[model samples]
Target chain A: MSDLKNLRGKAACVGAATTGCGEAPGRNSTELMAEAVIHALADANIPLHEVDGVFAATAVHSMAAMSLAEYLGVHPKYSSGSNIGGSSFLAHALDAAMALEAGLIDVAVIAYGSNQRTAGGFKSISEPMPFEAQYEPRNPITAYALATSRYMHDFGATRDQIAEVAVAARAWAGLNPEAFTRDPLTVEEVLAARMISDPLGKLDCCLVTDGAAAVVMTRAERAKDGPQKPVYLLGAAMAHDHRMISEMPDLTATSAADGGPRAFAMAGYGPNDMDTVQLYDAFTINTILFLEDLGFCAKGEGKDFVGGGRIAPGGALPVNTNGGGLSCVHPGMYGLFVMIEAIRQARGTCGDRQVDGAKLCLAHGNGGVLSSQVTTIWGTEETL
Target chain B: MSGYFDGPGPEAEFRQFLADGKFMIQRSKGSGIHVFHPRVMVPCSGETDLEWVEASGEGTVYAATCTRRRPEKGGDYNVSLIDLAEGPRMMARVVGIEPDQVMVGMKVRARIDDLNGAPAILFEPA
Candidate 1:
């Protein structure tokens, strides 16, 4: 019911943290989250006690707003503890911005933390619904495998073509000092990595790291008095199809196919206007599928679009500039990283990793086997 | 008389009082017709007049995936989305085929199997 045009806020993303990539740290989820929140507040030059709202997103652990507020030693006027999947963090930013515009809260802190890599922590605790119980557990890798199979069947795409996406990501990671796996990987290395699922190798899947990230958002007017630059929330959209992989109408096309255009239209920009992209990369297939679904390329042509150095650093569209969830730190909080990188690029604070002359960036998040999608367009200017 | 009814809780329960081998699908206690899973629900005009039908267990693979990485709780297995000839798609395990052998539109038949001592349906190449 909220109109995109009515949305107005001067929001500055302050502070961000990741545990890098690989094994889960010994630290608990709450500790990691609190650390990120404190760091973000310091980065924005704001006292931690001044934060008025808190929003948290997590899949592997639960931490309510009150508990987090207690941990951070800040009593927030407004709070949220919703879990909409990886993209939930970005959704939280939009929600915070709306709330700020409506005078609900002046400052909001959105954070995500998880320990998925720790032993005995990566499995679902609850049983599947009765309908879902009938089927085998289709993990993310398998969900992507089904879509990859269809992609190959329909487009005549080959393993080599898909491997190019990994190759490009690793190439970018080589340039990112904060990236988890910096070693340059070739198409063969990617193809030969331990096969997690048929047609999907170890390199094709994202790493599960233990980490947390936080962003302090406040009204543009408030942020203007704080940070030197404010990255405005130009547009945002969310969409869903079916929860279970089996019930999805089509595996290749995402709800983003609908959500992307709507967000872009709201922002008054197109794919070409984006200087950088932070797409959710749960797997190589998902990246390819989203490229098509987001209108970056034609349907069934994602493999071809990614084959060249297009997504590389100097290519047409520099994607996952922070190495993404694949090569960067994936805390099961993948969406947070996307937002972090987009803010960095839009603020032009990425230093050596900054996309030259960047102005517009797209941050995308995927939840539940690509079941839910949230697309956000951010800019250096205040559009509303 | 055997009948399916709502449980004391907010969930639906299937009460097998008769051995008619007939399964009636419905959206709610008071909807139009009875469909299957993923249909949201089948509307039935009245609960008493619900139509009962037999399942063929014959279907085709609408989509499938080979999973080498499954949650620790769920044993590793290949998963698939199957489309029945009667007009509904369901999730099941693909058996009797190599991971590379599974393809879309492949003919398959459902086989009810024991999953940790409970009844669960799986599929194999027909």
Candidate 2:
């Protein structure tokens, strides 16, 4: 939550795009980021010269905001590099909105790009080489697995329940032609898949591919001149709970618990008001925690909430409608794509997977093994 | 490494304790908070008055997972978080048992082992 409450300056996401998603071998991170920025500008029908604020994050790029600005040849008055983790994009989105609300900038570009699949598999050393590396907590996978193990021990959540998240994501992927893995998926198949880390099979983990996504944000009045109807930002919240998995205060809880309520209160909305949802799914364990902490279900009921086509197509709550990192395109950091998908759904631009006359959407991004959480709510003009 | 790492600055004494085959944690005199990772600051209260104390090294396995990267690669091992007796948790691998046998809440103790050609910490069922 920010000090700038009851923001009078209305902000809308006027444009968004994804580029070099999937296995794009030749496209480097720089090229992919540039492509996404250009595509996003075109989608907004705003010239590149109009962008006065820039925000960028990438696993492979340092000082990403400055690098992207140099590459795109666009100067900016406000710039920031929020490399919190996969959730950095959501953090950037919130930062952009806060800056816009404060009259710091008029137009902001939030961007991300990565070449994890094509350049190098997701086998690189930890960014700072997790301090506990010598003690051997196999990264993100095992670190997250520990939490899943504790969840089962505490709440009786089963492996099949966790696999259900993968099945739902894959089913949604089958609807989008741009999704990387669209083939049919099942619980048994997910359980049988190779185990990368205990309690998490290959299917339970997100895809490793080349991808980039970007969004253009401007005050609602400035967005009136854009190409498509603006998707207004109703509320946003970001929190950093911990950096290392061992330092997490509660094994099953994350910063999502802190950000979820604040964002909802900011918008005066609740879980039942959501027409659709898009949550970061770096690991199925993350979805379960978000499902519970985001108040989609009672605590410890996330395992049941996601099972038996609960989040799949035609379900009561359609989540990860554009496939998601699990089945769609998860380059390295995946938060930006959630914003892109949320914006698409808010604008009624999602082709076949669109929620029927959807008016409100919730997108949550988790970073650093559920350490950092950034939650944002979007709404069409009708809902506003 | 970047400048100004506020959490824990080069815990040289912690490493020295490790060299002597002893497990150590920081006990903040100001607040009596036991800090793992040899950090100087107390999490419960922002106090830097710390004293290094040898830990009991006995802990309960809060969580565990078997990490395997390939079918034919090196044998899988169990990574776990141990809730030490001092009320601090640590990241360490559980040894002397099959990777899948390390159960949560099981009793465990720390032992020094050579990892990546350097002395490091590991856990075994107590």
Candidate 3:
């Protein structure tokens, strides 16, 4: 088997794009996805016939790769429809990188779309676990609330500290014109929002929006011919610990703890080397937990590490520069959008929210109830 | 046909046991390792040498959250993960107190309760 560490910088993202988000009244998931795929291909200055690998995962379709391929009118030589929940897109990036490294396919297109917001709110994409379903926890929100309770209990982290994550995400969103909820948000407002579940109010949850995104990738050598500067995939790792939240070994920690080091090691860099970070913040507590698990701080120290605008725009670390799923467009699975934001930041294309001279950045995706984690390191041409 | 393979699956057997007013759990006959959700095989070893046994019904709250509901919609209820004394953790609710009052590390005891006209296991203060 090929070593994952050896796959570093084997593939680079040449093009990325997102369709109109928040509300596409009449557009179906596949329609939105095809639009994104077309736009991303155009951005790469590549035609549809150049894409030989199709990778996708969605809440709407079981055979997402096949569906996306059929919709785009291409017969791909390689395809993957593995769905590990919200992190499915990041997993696709890792899979695509491996395929590109092995010369299995020349060009790969990873795409995703969701109409959950207009389809009448988010539905549980994962099948209900026999044991966990009986308790009637409100799908993912309750699962996350349980984690919040345990995290707060173990570390004495207050609700105010947890609310800071949402506040920071909103602050970032205010700078992104494409963000869904860009109005200024406060910690107190988050605390006082209607309780979805104890310890997590409404503001702690991510926005329910309709959107689609696609990214085109190729071997690092071929990526140079693309229209936009290629963002190289320095390192990538994906992992999962459990399906049901109750079965998760540690509620306060996620699979990121396991994958983060492996990814960083593969890239020959650590958390400190990142100019910015993009995390799939489905809930406020997600930011706190992932920051800690990704080695930004000690296990219980995430609560304090994010306080006083540490992760906000003007803070030491610029996180969720595209506003994140918390305040940005979260159309069910948010993994792809995070990667797109990181890619934009690495390209130094983000206007108001861009991190100064961003070169090396980390984008992490979380799926299920912190079940699946894919940590990817993206860097600019200068880093190579 | 031989009767060696004739029975309800692990899930059905578990629900039937609950209906019989008995709280039960599964264990690996070889290693005595416990598992929850009544799976067919051992999670660690993937061995099929599993057997059921009566549980002590004693557990401790590992984590909890109170799900909010409107007043006419039965108000609120506490959903919790209880670490059973038998070494497996399971998801259930702790009752006999206010929903928000349920705290992590609190002792609890499992009991058979009716939910949606179906028998289920729930927990209460020990």
On DockQ, the leading prediction is: 3
Residue A286 of candidate 2: its Cα lDDT? 84
Model 3: colliding residue pairs = none
Candidate 3 is graded, for docking, as high
In the range A25-120, model 3's lDDT, one tens digit per residue, is 878899999999999999999999888999999898989999999988898989999999989888899899989888889999999988888888
Off by over 4 Å in 2: A1-4, A123-126, A129-131, B1-10, B69-73
What TM-score does chain A of model 3 get?
A: 0.98
Find the candidate with the highest lDDT and give its number.
3
lDDT of 2 at B104: 94
Best of the two (1, 3) by lDDT: 3
Location of the lowest summed lDDT over 10 successive residues in candidate 1 chain A: A118-127
lDDT of 2 by residue, A158-218 (tens): 9998899999999999999899999999889999999888888889888999988899999
Q: Which stretches of candidate 1 lie over 4 Å from their true place?
A: A8-10, A14-24, A118-129, A382-384, B1-34, B38-52, B69-76
The better candidate by DockQ, 1 or 2, is: 2
Q: Which one wins by DockQ: 1 or 3?
A: 3
lDDT of 1 by residue, A211-265 (tens): 7788888887777676547777887888888676766778778899988887887
